[model samples]
Target: MNQQQFEKMKHGQGFIAALDQSGGSTPKALAAYGVPEDSYSGEDEMFDLVHKMRTRIITSPAFNSDQIIGAILFEQTMDREIEGKYTADYLADQGIVPFLKVDKGLADQTDGVQLMKPIDNLDETLRRANERNIFGTKMRSVIHEPNESGIKEVVKQQFEIGKQIIAAGLVPIIEPEVNIHSEGKEKAEEILKEEIRKHLDQLSEDENVMLKLTIPTEANTYKQLIDHPRVVRVVALSGGYDRDKANSLLKENDGLIASFSRALADDLNANQSDKEFNTALQNAVDSIHNASVNKK
Candidate 1:
């Protein structure tokens, strides 16, 4: 990405709506949203419901407003059309940048850490994303505890992957999501911060990178990273928190914004009336936008 494009993304509304649920997680989300398991076929039903949810957000006024600056889309939904217009085109028309989730998924655990499964055909995937006018890409890996060695390996791998994406002329959202329910969350954040700095410190001055991390237990745990010269912006994932709690926590840290999936989509179901769905989306967007502005 060019410097001007990077500035637009970094300084925009900071609240990124994540609609990139993979096949494995989509079924559970559908059920949680009150879609009965036997209502339709198998994975197809799950994706269909996900498509409906994406359509709702894309059609909402709140989503078209400045409350949401960017959105992440699953591969299946990225190219789909709304009202005969491509989803990416619709988002760009509304001034909300579109991002694609490029990681395959998580792999088996090693040393208590779950590494993100590398994309098998990343070059072609990135080429398609670029052709589709995607603004960025996000990939996820998991951190279970504050193991220094494990954290270093995770950081190394993430940065290596990020380098490839950056070289492909697209921004990368490096996500090493810490399990919120794990013990010693505070210590884990400290370790994660150190590992991040270790890799960032080695980067050339022009190699700007972005991070999408789990909310830290303490407000200033990631302050150093937010201020790092090579770090463009720092964003937080909702992890397992609900919208209310997630917003509350997001406000505790300065320079942190949200890239929330479940929290952003909370309370809307396939059964809601149009008015009800719109109300839910508006309330969620308002809260998340307010939190992003109140990050201090």
Candidate 2:
């Protein structure tokens, strides 16, 4: 691991930018960016358009290290270049750390949750990410209700993959998101916390990891996890919440910072002028940054 990047990740005061929309989510992401479904006929064209969108966002003055500590990227984006430099290298140049989304998306729901699909060639992926100066990886799983066995299984899979990532010398953002609209949301969070604590306790003193969770039903639900010796940081996923609501809930939790996707891109439109785009992005960044570091 790069010590400088590690120090920045451990101490940085801003949120991470989630720009890792994969094949499953790319169409939705692009449509929201004002590109209709008919705009592209195939996967290649779709990816090209999304890459352009990502490039525009990355190159924008509003997207910078001052308010963004890191960015999580898709595999395609990681392999692509920005202004004659690799995506991760460009982020590093701007003083922002880069991470890759390492999972192969979610498997079919079972046991009230959806775990990650088996990742093929994970070792090769991690090797490539490391070679590109990437500092970490993010993978996601989802829980719909408080099924103890299901939640336990989700966390278990996450840690197992996380250990693999760690062994490859990269931090893993272990994310087991409880569905924001789950009928038994609070109870689910409780079970999720217990499972996470068990794993954190098992980690060696020298091992460090990050957690990405949904904003809990109650404030400070992950307080112990936030302060855990093995946890480097704990970030919150927007999880379908609008920007205002997500930030509002985030303020109620003291240590967690944002790693928003849709919320971050909420007001941005493909047709907006550069000035308008930057203004909108700056407003979102400021609000999220305030909620992150200037707790209510």
Candidate 3:
């Protein structure tokens, strides 16, 4: 889709999920999950597999085919190949839109979120991708402030960050969450929803309304977050490295989430244990599909 088309997505309710494929996630398995093998863990050997998975998604009547596959092109090893395919001609040849995710994640001064800090190298990365004719992009900025000041800080920082991006012609996914738990986790999700809405509304004025968002299932159910009119989309990010819980959450939400992914993908990317990771991912997909069918 074009930039204008993407901007119009704000009117489309329900969340867009970032399909989770991390931690020893094999291309063969991702193929089974409906993502092209070439799309992740890049290998010419699995090009056919990737093609098959994508084709299935496109043809699947049960699943939303506009589904996004996250972290596919983010790997440094895969950039060279993917960027080549992002060119205008390459786009025409492929006949598919790639939603690039850019996020300058949180910094706790230590720990996992902090360690990944100065995240998503958004500016320079998108510049290169845009030059490669890679147009549509999504930036997921995770801010760690759990109180009002943190909320305000996230709004200001994300706005400044987003203004720079929209000017350069890329979409930003404004994701400011209180990690898995924060001072407010004990409060209610409305606090999180309200905080997110404020950020999004403020960011909405940044150049255009093209900024897409990923609202966690935790936040929603914790406070019945989906009730917000401003929350145009929902995203279920895998949590605590548990597939059963992740799948259970997916079923609980009734396909409201359009995307799903987690740190497991990081583990997969780094060549970590793929056994438990793959099993969890499969359960999530199965649960989501079952939930979609029976509304369970």
Candidate 4:
């Protein structure tokens, strides 16, 4: 993501950020990022994530008191592992919001099957959340993977998911992730930009989504899928290693970038290294700084 693109995104239209696998490094990394963190981690890990959220809010120049700090529990919620009744209440107690990752994503179910498959505990689980009063609910779609869909499944799923959430009165995180990881941040950004275009094709006149968990940052393939009219009310996502890239991506589009590491439960190294996450962010900031100095 670059300055021009960053300038284009609508501000305060927050993006979702992910925690890297390091159970401990998130807060320090986000502080280095100069942005607030919104996290998604396991039940045991809330201690660390909440601390990260609080510290980022207190210290970062970007902190907004009105915004939320939260996490997405895909494996736990989908598998019926969370104690939904008190979980939301518990998170609020810690100054964190909780979201149920409603999208079913996996390679085998790629085209259409994934989106149509009802959330494992859809109606009942949300009811539990509402009763307990969790901050909101988020759902995603596994649309256009290795096989792009002319079948129009993303839009179909979008309508279905949006309607359901509206009925339930939960804020929907509509993330249609084409998150095929890449070592090159620019390449990753490319893939994401295209993914954003594809997903946004579903946006209607009313444009019902509360957010797009991931928005494209790199320019590489973004233009390939660029046909949508903006439907996302806000934009954000959580991923590992892209805070700065994520920062640049959102800045270009004039949107928000919420923080998360891809899946820190698995990567012990990334979890511990603040340097890793901040490098891209630092590079991004430096680029802007250099450009500003040059302009002057």
Candidate 1 residue lDDT tens string, 1-296: 64555766778765888989888888777776778778868777668777887887789876864778888888888777877877777787887778899999988878667888868999998898888788788999898877777878888889999988888888888999999998967787898899899889998876778899999998868989989988878889999998889899999988898889989877787788888888988888889888987765
Locate the minimum summed-lDDT window of 10 residues in model 4. Answer: 1-10
Q: Taking the tens digit of each residue's C-alpha lDDT, what string does model 4 give over 158-195?
A: 55676676568565666555443523434434444454
- Lowest summed lDDT over 10 consecutive residues: which window, candidate 2? 2-11
TM of each candidate vs. truth: 0.95, 0.99, 0.56, 0.50
Clashes of each: 0, 0, 18, 43
Model 1 RMSD, rounded to 1 decimal = 1.5
Residues 36-79, model 3: lDDT tens digits: 54455545545434343333332233223232222223322224
Residue 154 CA error for candidate 1 (Å)?
Answer: 0.9
Overall lDDT per candidate, in order of appearance: 0.84, 0.95, 0.43, 0.43
Off by over 4 Å in 2: none
The per-prediction CA RMSD against the true structure, in angstroms, equals 1.5, 0.7, 7.9, 10.0
Off by over 4 Å in 1: 2-5
Question: Candidate 3 regions off by >4 Å?
Answer: 1-72, 75-78, 82-96, 109-122, 133-145, 181-183, 186-188, 203-232, 262-286, 289-296
Ranking by lDDT: 2, 1, 4, 3
In model 1, the Cα lDDT at residue 269 comes to 79
